[model samples]
Structure formats: structure tokens, C-alpha cells
Target: MERDLSRQELTAETLVLWEKTRMSLRNCIKRVMRSHGVEDHKVWGTVHAYAFEIVKLLGTIDALIDHVTKGSSTREMHPWVRNPLRVATYEMKWRDLKPAIATSEAVRIISERVGDGPARFANAVLYDVEEVTLEEVLEKAEDEIERLSIEYSHPTWYVKHLLDLLGRDELIELMKANNEEPVRYLRVNAHLKDPDAVILALEREGVVVEEDPHVPLILRVVEWNVPPVRTEPYRRGWVTYQDKASAAAAYALAPEPGERVLDACSAPGNKAAYVYAYTCGEVELTCVDINPRRIEEMKRNFKRWGVEAEVVRADAARLKGVLNGGFDAALVDPPCSSSGSYNRTPEAKWTVKWRHVRRYAEGQLRILRGVADLKPGRMVYSTCSVTVPENEDVVHRFLSHEDTYSTRKPDVPVGSPGFDRWMDRRYRHHRHMIRLWPHRHMTEGFCVTLLEGG
Candidate 1:
């Protein structure tokens, strides 16, 4: 029999993996672009995941770069500026950690690889890092980008974009909110128990929790790491890991028990599972994705939740052969550039060149148009992207071309309205859409648009 690793052992391994993954992520982006003929979604997406986990441990990569370039130990600095030590300094200075402890961990973790002299240099320079007021830092920075980046602990492009969209004061609050550890939110499986009861159950288990006004069954974890999905209640198909905003997308669809629903692009099937949970297994759900591996994940999630859904590995755009106006509703959560997810997936900021956003928007429109023709009744179109081009623009273009389709606002309780006309005139009716932002909603930026048609 294999021995189960203890928590301390797991944590130690996770830390080491985190450091190595960070290095790989930074290197992979450049290497893939240079050696491989392709630099597409899959490569960038995997890199983004690695980058996200790295930032969660060590904070922003930008700050690490700045420190390496300016630190006193220039001779000892890693030539690439994407080393574990640089990330270590950012964590010590910006993230909540004593400088000595963070730097010591960095040295311990990277000493052999970085060499004795470089390790010593890293330790020395990190000790010099001191906490300063945002005001003090901003006062010292002459450039607006540098000032905002340091003050908010985000990339310059991200800060500039936020400033343009939300203005300076709001950007500060947004950035501050993003830098903090993200809260884990859950969608209670109402099939097993009511949300209120679930909250009580969690509290009884010594979990500190809070309910947000914006979403139903969305519980924010103040403390505790009890894997709810692994618990008996969850095994009995009672709870699932779902964001407040994501729950809203399924809720907006309001899939009634016994309704036939199609979940297009349902890879890793959280939303499809939520639909089953929400309706308590009464709905006949068909979940489809292009990747067979993702179809397998959907099956695993379904098995975990004790829910049944027809999982298909097929292109959502080419679903014409499967059913002919046979579904009551459908969910189209298409692939996107994920700009609004920068706070949670910081690696995306690095991979996202200016052209990527436009390209994603164009692809999103194509998918929306393809799916609009197949909606038997009302369908919900969604993405994890908060950008106007991908969210509202695609919806707008779909609506313009298919005049038979009209916007149907999901009756979600809370979320800021979509961007203003000044930002994007095409999304005028986007107020009905839900825009979840890390700065505002404390979740990844997600937009869901409800469409009504044949």
C-alpha cells in the first residue's frame, strides 16, 4: 500500500512545484514562440494557468522584474529576470510575509541552482526591501505607468487599461482588491440541501463563511480548507465549487426541472453540473465540447456530483446533426482571451499582446452566430472575459445579423451593468448582462448574456 502524504509534506512539495512552474511559465512563452511554429490558445492557456498559480504564491511578476533590474546585487541577478529569487523578493516586499522569512525561503529553495554567491546576493538585497506607503511610492515615480504598477502591484498595461475604463481612484481600489488573496466561493447544491442549511453545516464544521448579496448559494470562505466536494454531503451530490457570477449564468437560464437543455462548450463541466444541481437532476442535460479529454472531465464531474448528463466530444459549432430544435435552452460559454481574469490569472497579462483581444472577439462572434441559429428557446451566451469586444460586441453582432433573436436579461440579483456607450456603443443593452470583476465582485471577470429566439 502507498502511504498518503501528510499536509506538511504536501505543502512543502507544492511550494517547490510553484517555484519551478513559475520559471517554466516565463521561459515557455518565449521558447514556444521562437522554437515552435505555433503560439496559439492552448500554449498560452496552459502558460496562463502556471502563471496564475505562481502569482498566487509570489504576487505580480512585474514587481519581481522591477526589483531585479534595480536591486543593488546586479551582478548576481538572474540574466532572464524570471527566476525564483526575483519572485521571492516580490512576495517578501508586497505579499504578507516577513522579509527575512521570505528571503530565507527563496535562498533555501534556489541556492543550489543559483549558486552560493547569487543566493547570498539575493538574501542581502531582499533584506533591504522595506514597506512603503503607496503615496510615498507614487510620489517617487515620475512615470504614470510605473507609479500605478508599483502602487497597485499590477502590470503597467493592466493599470493603464483599468485607469481608462474605471478612472484613477477606482483603479486604485480595484488593484488593491486584486492583490489580496482571492476568496473561495461556492454554489450550494440545492438538490441535497438549501443554501442556508449548507451554510449552517459549514459553520458547524468550523468554517468561517459569508453570503454575498450578488449571488444565490454563493458562500465566500473567510477560513477553512475543507474540500466540500470530497465531504459526504458533497459525495451525496450536495455542494460544488462554483463562483457567484458563474452560478448566475445558469440561474439566468433558469433551467426548470425536466427541461431539455444543451450545454455547448461544456468542458470541465462546472456550469453543466450546476445546472443539474440547480434543477436537482430533473433536467435532461446534454453537455458538449471539442476536446475528448474535457469530455472525460465533464464525465468525472458528473460522476462526482452523482448527476447524469449526456457528455459528447464534438464541436459545439457543428452540433447540427445531434438535435434539430430539440432543446428548450442552451449555454454557450465560448473560448475567450480572458483579459478580465488578469487579477486571478496574472500570467494572461504577459501573454496577451494587443492583437489577442481583437482576435478573441472575432472568434467569439463566429461562435455566437453559429449557436444562435440552434437555440430552441432562450439561450445564455457567456464567457470569462470582461472585455467589451468579446462580451458585448459579439452579442451585438449576433443580434444584428439574426434579427429574430432578442436580448433576454438574466434575473440575477446583483452585479454592475455592462460598460457604458462611450466605452462600446454596441453593448447598449448590456446593462442586463452580469459583469463580475475581481476589483468589484471579488471574482474573475465573467459576462453572461441571455438571448431569446426560436
Candidate 2:
């Protein structure tokens, strides 16, 4: 009977720890992935499972530490104590739970798991931890690494990398943004409604949407929990749920009716649907992705939009064996570090590390090399990553190394220019790459580079 009561409280505390600890494990997994080149879909299931174990273990340890530290008042200890103490403090401060309840839950979870001594230690420290403010605790932190870790609840290295990319102010905004639930964006499926008409339709339906100047047909939904997609307009394929930035790729491709299009790495067929719709179903589209599971999902989406395309599960880098060189256009939305889309999938930021970004860049280069072989005069090579190494830099390296490929600007509404020096160095004759960001354009990060064949 007593065990059941204790278990219930531990469970409540575990829920709080679960969210915090899962975030930690996600950061760790991303760090290790680049060394090994693992994808998120493969690791996310493990992350979900490991989150429970991590919280349970951390809660147990905090309890144990408190047991050892008893008799000491909260004022005596340094604000930054053990990991579990820090975690418990997060629960009390940020989570809005009763401090005593938070402390007891940590103690219960620890004592039940680790026997008496460790549990006593965790209990004692947690009792002393209730008074410490997150800001005060961070001030007591010895270094930037420790400070950012406690302050943002992120791994130290990840915070440093963000600081390197975005500097101090922007990085803080990015981190705070990631911690919140993301806004959902939609791409007006052009097959159903032209961009202007779609906006009017959404407004008429009481769905507030703002145009993304950087992206062609992307719309940002101001109010969440409103399932605008379920509305008659959306049900009739007027708009598709996609990041505004992501929609830029297919729109840049700008397929014309009766054109032959190849979409490499196109599973979960948002782009394929966009291709068929944007071209008004005039183009013959061939879509492919390596994962069969994603292919099935793409098929479902394709069906939903009432667009027909030849879908295959195959590697884009090895498509020479299967697809001929007759394709007039191709879209390579290959695997990437979802740096730009992190706003939509906050869980993604947790999974990104410096190494994974490099691996994605290398893999994208190989995919681009394969794309060059198709002899496409116009192709879109895009990623949902805002990282220079993955977007402009990847295109630069590809053009520098691949003798047959060049660059061009498409006919669509122009967005941001490509990186200044990189373009001058690689394609001085033409600069047609487009960069999109959430902060500027109110969408996820996306880049679309137009390539002209040799």
C-alpha cells in the first residue's frame, strides 16, 4: 500500500523530469551521431525510451544526494549542486509545481530505487535546493559552459555553437523559441487555389494567415489550435500543411505542365504534391526516397491531394542505375540538419549537434553529385537548414568540384541572394540561390539553389 502511494508521487515527478531529461539525451545523441552518421528517425524512438530511464535515474540520484546532505540549510550549499538538484530546482521554478511536492517526489523516486544512503543524500540536497533561484544558480556557475547549460537547459557545446552562428542576442531568441511549442505554417497548394485567392479563402474561413514575402505561397498561422486544415478550403486541397520555407523548393522548381520532373529524396511527398499541384498536374513527376516507410506516408499525402506521381523507394545517389537522363527537372530535398525547421519541430533542436551538420553536408554533396549526372539544365538542390556549410557552402563546393554543373536564377519572385563571396568564387557569372528564415520571413529555415547543367 505504501509502495503504491510512493510510486504515484514518483510518477508525477518523473513526468517533469522526463521532459527535461529527454532534452538532455537528445543533445547527447546528436553529438554522437556525427561521429557515427546516424539519422534522427533511427534514433528518436530510442530517445523516447531513454528519456523515462534518465528522469527516473536522475530523480533517484537527487533523492540520494539530499539524504547525504541533510542538516545543512539551503543557504549553506552553492546554488549549483548536483545534476538532480538542478533538475529538481527546474521543476520547482519553471514547472510551477509545489516546491515541497517536487522535493518529495525526487526523494521518493531516489529512495525507492537506490536504497537508504543515496536516497537520504538526494533528499537533503533537494531540501536545501528550494531557495535557489535559477538566475542565482547560474551566477554561481563557474564557466560559460556550465552557465549556459543550467540557464538554457541545453548541452554546453550546443549553446556555444549557436552563439558562434547567431551571436549572443539571436542565439538567446533562438533558444527561447525552441523551448516553446512551434507555430504551424502552410503552403497554399497551388493546384487548388492561386496564392492570392488562397489568402482570401483563409480570411473568409476565419483563419488568419500572413504572407511570407521571402517565400512564394507560404502562410503563417497566428492562432494555434485552430485546425484550418480541416476547413472546406483545406479539405479541397487549397492549402497543405508545410513550412513556408520548405515550400520554396518546389515553387522554385516551378514545374510547367507536360514537363518531366524527378524528385530525388522525395519521400513523405510534400514536395511531390507541391510539384504536381504547382504545375497544375501537367508535369509527369517521379518521386523517390530511400525509406519505404516514408514512401508509404508520401503516398497517403499524394492521394489526399489528388496528385499522381510515380513514387519509388530508392537511393538518389545511385539512381543512374534505374532512372534515365531524360528528366528535364529534378528536386533534391535531401537529408539535412533541420536547423531552419527547428521552430516547427522543437524536438529537432535537441537532436542537432555540430557533427550531424557536417555529416548532412557531406551526404548532400554526394546527392548533388548524383543530381549532376542526370544532365538537368535546371534543378533545385535545397535543405531546411540555415547553416552556411549546408546551404550556400554545399552548393559552392558542388559547383567547384563538379565540372558539368553551373548556377542560375529562376523566374519566381526573388528572395535573399546567395552568400556574397561564395557566389563570386564559384558562379561569378550568375547568383540565383535563395535563403529563407523564420525570423525574417515568418517560416522555417530553407534554401533553394538553382543549378544549370554544363
- Using TM-score as the measure, the top candidate is 1
TM-score of each: 0.78, 0.72
lDDT of 2 at 422: 35
Poorest 10 consecutive residues by lDDT, candidate 2:
1-10
Error of 1 at 230 (Å): 5.8
Q: On residues 60-139, what C-alpha lDDT tens digit does candidate 2 reach at each position?
A: 23333333355553234332223345445556654666888877766655565555665577676666566544455556
lDDT of 1 by residue, 145-209 (tens): 77777655565666776687788888788767665556677777776687788887777666657
Which residue ranges in model 1 land beyond 4 Å of their true spot?
1-82, 94-109, 120-142, 193-200, 208-214, 220-230, 342-344, 422-426
The global Cα lDDT (0 to 1) of model 2 is 0.66
Measure candidate 1: CA RMSD: 7.5
Candidate 2 regions exceeding 4 Å error are: 1-90, 105-122, 140-166, 192-206, 211-216, 229-238, 410-415, 418-431
Model 1: weakest 10-residue lDDT segment is 5-14
